[model samples]
Target: MNVTEVISPTVKCRVHLHVHLDGAVRPSTVWELSRQKKLLLPGNGSLKDLEEALQIRSPRDLAHYLQKFRWITPAIAGDLAAIERIAYEFVEDEARRAVLYTEVRFSPHLLVGPGGQVTARQVTEAVMRGMARGERQFGVTARLLLCCIRGMTENYDDTLDMCTEFRGQVVGIDISGDEASALDVDGSVNAGLLRAEVRTFQEAARRGIHRTVHSGEAGPASMVKLAIDEMKAERIGHGYHVLEDEELYRRCVSTGVHFECCPSSSFLTGAVPLTETRHPMQRFCQDGASFSANVDDPAITRTGLEDEYALLRRMGFNEANIATMNFNAAKACFLPEEEKQDLLQKLRQAYGVPGCD
Candidate 1:
């Protein structure tokens, strides 16, 4: 049986909260773009070669996993047309997997390649146009989120500014990148950079921009606490390590901070071990914490939203549990109050879950 046969029997509508726009570029698209731009590809430069190269079959550190971007990113980055095409394609891909709503994220500055003529605003505009067209064509309600890479202190303000400028289309702001590199050997946090990141999130909060931080994926539990307490993150990306601290985990459960869990990506990135008896999300589910399963990087993990649900099933989460997680995702989405309510109602009708609304 395939992924759809396994996942479609139980989980119906889905709300995906954590996925990177750049990381989801279609391998075929990457192949075509690389050929068009005369860019080099691994092996024979065929589509199969590109596909084989993008996937991370061997588990490695976070930094090693990120290096995969160097292959596909150059194809989409600095090219406004490529960015727009991929954005439109992203919606269609998600819609096929029964994702009714999704919030895709990327850093605009990164899209503006080295010495490229395109401005950050233009990059955002292209993505918005593509996604807008996609929404009409594919029937998936899509939103945007700007990302600030950790250690790139210079781009934080631009990310927040874009979130404020594109409030309705761009739903929120996020921070993602190497967590270990941000700390010293003694575990001393990089105070200056941390303060700058905090200031950016504080401004985002004051401007009413929704905030989510990539924390505690490969870092310690303290990063999750800092993301919640100092950065005012409304949701956490990955966040498996939050379970390391019992007090913090209990507090998170009480407060209902959403966790965007990516099972395949977490394993491939070495954030979680293959031989573990229990997964952190199992604890989150048992403790009544709010969390959702997602595909962090389809390009790398070679999985989809349905694949994530299947993984959750294998991890011992039942159909009801998966439905509740989808409901939790709908609740935690960054859409406006009225739109969010509409989404919840749609989910209620789709899942036919009593008292879910």
Candidate 2:
């Protein structure tokens, strides 16, 4: 499962394991959803202004980029049909780009409608409905990864309860949201916050729910190790910062914990420069560190899986290096062994490599 062993990507690699469901919605859909929901666009008072905002230069950092989510979160959360459309449209978008598989993440608590009208189960089911329709219509295999935001403690229990309720429906649990934020959504920020929060993740571990963590992107590499030794994360979301600590990076490579690198999003974050010879993606690959390409927030960054590949290509990654990332992504999925192997077999076939099955 070493990342450096991936086959040459002679064929186009379209398999993605990391994407945010709410952030993958179509731009046109965003406009329509905003209009229907009467959600005021952030920093965009007029249609002209909104257009400019969409094309606005990416914010300075991860925290800064997240500010745009205020408008996006409201538009998709309050309405059932809107959520469904968001899912369906994302799959359709995936199909158009020839992406065969993807794991989409979103927090159900954030999807609560006006007045806390929707239960976590209802919101999850709504997303499932759209996922089902999208899979059927577009021939893409997708699964949901329910995200437990770090700062939102009160709803974490309810969210985890609902996730357990829909156990067979979603693939796994993910610890997500803004780790850089000083306070949780509930206005609590004791130094012991993350220590206490690991309790919820431990519950997920006891229930045998697979876990992945959003760390090492904006945060330090130490956060990545905390997620592994403490949170039981099997893979990492945007863990490019692991390069900062050679020892931790080596540990991850040895243990086979995959790092999902979203170059376009990282470029926006100002953390990892996407240079041809200097990007973290290249560095990780060169060092044989396990990592793969992804679109962290497609709508927020306005990039897709193909564009990410293109970025790597522009950065001097050959076809084989690109294929190595595809192989790493497939092998790193939070799926059952048989399913993971099958997907890897498919990736090998697409890349014209030797079969594993």
Candidate 3:
């Protein structure tokens, strides 16, 4: 849609968090890389065919939503050039969508070669290089968040080490996967794996790295509490289910623990119930909760920050609500205090928030 051409510079000052680098890779890029590498295609092997295969048309559960990655990951995984290209393009896409500042997250272990052909350090450096170039050209500030995938305990330490090594560039850590699959029907997590994940986050907390966890989306409210209490999560990713527990919901609202809300993804992943009643975000808005709108996986969901904001508008969000969310996002961002104030000032100027200037 060439969003860059349409969006005016005045409104291009929003803050975004919770987008995945791998999930946002351009479809055409995936098509070309897959064909060059001779990777299998879904249908006729054309770019259009690959695009159709990469996007999830039918809304499904979290597991089904995640399966779409199989089509794109092989095309870029372990390939340094492809990884860098995707990371660079991600910034361009966000800039077009009016995202002034964004923190893109990914699992470095997943990007490494199947046989350890590339190191995690190399993968992170390639991403940093691409994002740095993109920032220079596009004028959109970008940062990194290294993710630790659930059920992959071996990679937890490496993720932390990478975050420590790239402290300024890599601002925080997250654990993302199928939240439902991570817990049993009774809501208990795997003891050993949970312990390992907790240890990584504890160390991150001790080391002064910011922490966020993917919880309460496909899982129960208890999972959200566990994330904050045990994993030391300062922010939450797709925390729609937090409303399931009144105490937790109240606590979140009172404590101002920011929720990275992905409206389209919440629906596509079946995290929120499809109903005519008010959406969780509406409740969040009415309750004055600390949260921000985000695009979880743009390519897979076939959306961007603009699409997300439009959906929120349809769901009854106003300019003030969106502006407040952006302010919340800026305050919740992992940027250093000085940079954060700068971002807030920019937002205040852009949104014309009174009494700040």
Question: What overall lDDT goes with each candidate model?
Answer: 0.89, 0.77, 0.89
| Residue-level lDDT tens digits of model 2 in 1-357 | 652233223343467878888777766677778887677774645655565565438447766777767657777776888888898888777776667778888998888876877777788899999989999987778888898887788877776676677766677888777766534455443347686557877888888877888888777776777788888888888887777778878888898888888888888876675343488788888878778889878877777677888888988888788778878887787777898887887777877776641
Which residue pairs clash within candidate 2?
Answer: none
The digit string of per-residue lDDT tens for model 3 on 225-315 reads 9899888899999888888899989998999999999999998898886763878899999999999999999888889887898999998
Query: Among all windows of ten consecutive residues in candidate 2, which has the lowest summed lDDT?
Result: 3-12
By summed lDDT, the worst window of 10 consecutive residues in model 1 runs over 3-12
Best model number under lDDT: 1
List residue ranges in candidate 2 displaced over 4 A: 1-13, 42-49, 56-59, 182-191, 273-277
Query: Candidate 3, overall lDDT?
Result: 0.89
1-357: candidate 1 lDDT, tens digit per residue: 554323233433899999999898889899999999999999998999888988888898888889989988889888999999999999878877788899999999888987866889999999999999999987889999999998899988888888888889999999999887667787656766588889999889999999999999999888899899999999999999998888998899999999999999989999998878899899899989999999989998999987898999998999999989999999999999999999998898888764654
Each candidate's number of clashing pairs is 0, 0, 0
Q: After superposition, how far is residue 187 of candidate 3 from its true place, in Å?
A: 3.1
After aligning candidate 1 to the native by TM-score, how far in Å is the CA of 151 from where it should be?
Answer: 0.9
Instruction: Find the 10 residues in a row with the least total lDDT in model 3.
Output: 3-12
